[model samples]
Target: MSPPRVETVLIVDDSLVQRLHMVGLLRQCGIHGILEAVDGNQALELLSALDTLPHLIVVDLEMPGMDGVEFILQMMKRNVMAPLVISSNRDLSLICSVENMAQALEIPILAAWKKPLTKQHLAEILHHSPDRPPPSHSTPETHKEASSTGAHELALAISRHQLLPYYQPQIDLKSGTITGVEVLARWPHAEKGFIPPDHFIPLAEKHRLIHDLTLEIAGQAFAQAAHWRRSGVHLTVAVNLSPRLLDLPDFVSEIDALLQQYQLPAEQVIWEVTESSLAADLGIALANLARLRLKGFGLSIDDYGTGFSSMQQLSRIPFTELKIDRSFVHRAHQREHLRVILQSALDMAHKMSLVTVAEGIETLEDWKLLREFGCNLAQGYFIAKPMPGETFTGWVKTQNTRRHGRRGS
Candidate 1:
C-alpha cells in the first residue's frame, strides 16, 4: 500500500553533463520522468509542444543565443507559469536574481541555487512545494530571466533607491480648484522604457518587495510635497493601498510613523482602498479606516461600483469620499439607467454626508453630464491624466499664474 510517485520535471541548461546529473538526482528522489533542454528556447519549445508543461523548470543563467533572462521575459509574456529554480555553478550574483524577475512581471519563482544540484536542495524546494508548482505568476518574477544584465541593472536601481513617484490630479468642484493628487509609481529601467505598474507592482507584492516599494513611494511623495510647500503649493497626495498591505494590522501604524518621519500633515495624506479591499476583512477594514480618519487622514473608495459588496461595503465602512467608478460613468449616457445608477449613488452618498467624486471623465459630454448631475468633483482624461510630481506642481502654478494674468488684464 505505497503512495503513487510524483510526475517528471524539466531541466533547462546548455550543459548536457549537468542535465544528466540532475536527471540522476531526480531518479533518486522518485521523480521518473525527466525532460531536458539545452537552452531557454528549446526548453520553451518543448514545454509548448507537450500536452502538459513539465512539473518544474530548473533554469541556468548562462546559455546560448536566448539566455535564461530572455527566456524568462518570453515566459512572462506568454503566461507560461511553473515553479522555477535558478541553478548555476556560480554564486548568486546580482544577475542570478533575474530568475526572480517574474515577480515584477507577476511570474513567481520558487528558489535559486548554485550549480551541482543536490538532493537536500531538491528536498527543501519540495518540502514547501510538494503538491503544486509555486504560482510563478505571483509578484516579483524571477529577475534572472528579464533581459541581458537586466537582472543586475534593475537590482542596482532598486537598491540605489532610484524608483520614483509621479502624480495624477484629483479636482475639487466646490471651489472649482485643483485639489489633491494621486501618487503613481514610476521606474525608468534603463532597458525597460517606463516599467508599467502591471509589470512591477504585482511582482513587488508577490516577493514581499512591496514593503520597500511602498516606503520608497511614500518618502518620495512626502519630499515632493515638502518641496512644493516652499513654493507655496500644497496638495494632498493619495496613494493606493493594496489588499496585501492593508491586511496587516500595523499598516495604519506604519503610515503614522511615515507621516511623523516626513513631517507631513496627516490631513495632507489620503489613502485609496478598492472595493475588493473592504470585503476582505470588513471588521478590520472599518476599524483601520476609523483609525486613519481619526488621525486626520482622508479615505476614499476607489473603483467603487465594481466590487460584489457595493451596498454592504458602503454600509459597513464610513468612507469620507465615495468614488463613482469609471466603468459606470463611461456608459452612463448609453444605458440611461446607468445615469440613474450614478444619481442613486450620489443620493446615497449625500444621505450619508459623504462627498462623491466622479472618475474617468474622458469626454466633454461626460464632463457636462457629471457637473450637471451634482457629482462633487471630476477627474480623468478630461481633467488630466497622471503625470510626474514636478509637472503637476508646475501645472498648478501655471494655472494660478493664468488666473492672476486674467484678473490683471
Candidate 2:
C-alpha cells in the first residue's frame, strides 16, 4: 500500500498536456489539492495570491517565459521554503546541475526527474520529502540540535569541555561489516542542548581556536578507539583534519603525541581532509600532509566531487581513500546521470588504488546500488546515524546480529 500522500501540489508547465498528465498522476496517487500554472511567471502570481503554500511544487525546466531556473532563483530571493520536484526534458546532466543549484540556494529539492513523469517516480519523490521522518532512531536528535549564538558562546563551551565526538560507522560494502567510523564533533550545550558542529566549527576556525578544538576532539576520538580496541572491536577511527591545524608547525607532532598517549597504532586512525582546506597555505599543508602520510596514518579526500581542485589534490596528496559526497549517492539509482557519475567516480578511485567511501547512503536501494558499484566503504543514515560513544558498541552488536541472521536465513 502507498503511504499517506501529500495534501496539496502545484504543477507548473508550459504544456497544458504535461500539466494535465501530472495532475492525473497526483490524483491517482490520492493528492486532490492541485494547482496549475502555464509558466513560471504565472506560477509566481498564483503563489502570491494563495493564502497558504502548497505542500509540494512540481516544475518543468523548459518554460516559455521566466524559465524554471529564473523562477527558482526568484523563489530563493523571495525566501520560499516549500519543497520542490523539478521535471525537465532537458539533458539529465543539466537537470542534475539545476538540482545542485537549488540545493546551494537553500531550497529543499525533493527530486529532479526527466519529463513524462510516472506514478512510481512521483511516489518516490513524495515518499522522500524532507517532512518524512528519518529511518534512523538517532538522526532526529543529532540533526535538530539546538543552535549556538556566536564565537563567544562557542569559546566558552569549548573551555568547559562540552565538545565531544560522535561516531558514525562506515560499512565495508563487500564484506557487509563495520570496518571504520568517522569521528564527528558534537557540542551538547548545558542549557541549550546539542549544538551542531556547523555552529561552532566555523567559529573555532575564524577565531583561530581550530587548533585547540581539533586536538580536543582528536584526543577524545583516540581514547574511544582505544576503548573499542580493548573490547575486541578493532575499527579504524577517522578524524577530520582542519587546514588551520596544518598551518601550525607542531600540528603533525601534536597528533603523533596524542596517538602515543593513547598507545593506538598510527595505522588505526585516518585523517579526512577537504580540498579547500588544503588550499590554505599550500606549501605548509602539503608538507604536513606528507609528514602525516610518512608516519603511517591514512589520508582521505573527503566530499570528493564538491571540491574545485579535487583532481589536483589527488595528484599532490597521498590520499588513501576517496569519499564520494552525499549529493552523488542519495538518489543515484533513480537518476541515470547520477549513476553514471557515481560509477565513474568509483572507477577512478579504483584505478588510483584508493578506497572509495560513499557518504549518505539513506535508502536500501542506495545500499544495494553501492554494493553493485563495488564502493569500498559506505556511511550515512541508512547504516546508522552518528551516536554517542556509549551506544556505539551496542549498535555494532545489533548490526552483527542482523548480518548473521540474514546470512543464516
Worst 10 residues of 1 by lDDT: 143-152
Task: Evaluate model 1: give its TM-score.
Answer: 0.61
Model 2 TM-score is: 0.90
**What does candidate 1's lDDT look like per residue over 192-211, in tens digits?**
56666665777677766676
Error of 2 at 133 (Å): 12
Error of 1 at 144 (Å): 14
Which parts of model 2 are misplaced by more than 4 Å?
Answer: 2-5, 132-148, 190-193
Global lDDT of each candidate: 0.75, 0.87
C-alpha lDDT of candidate 2 relative to the true structure: 0.87
> Can you give the lDDT of residue 380 in candidate 1?
85
Best by lDDT: 2
What local lDDT score does residue 2 receive in model 1, on the 0 to 100 scale?
31
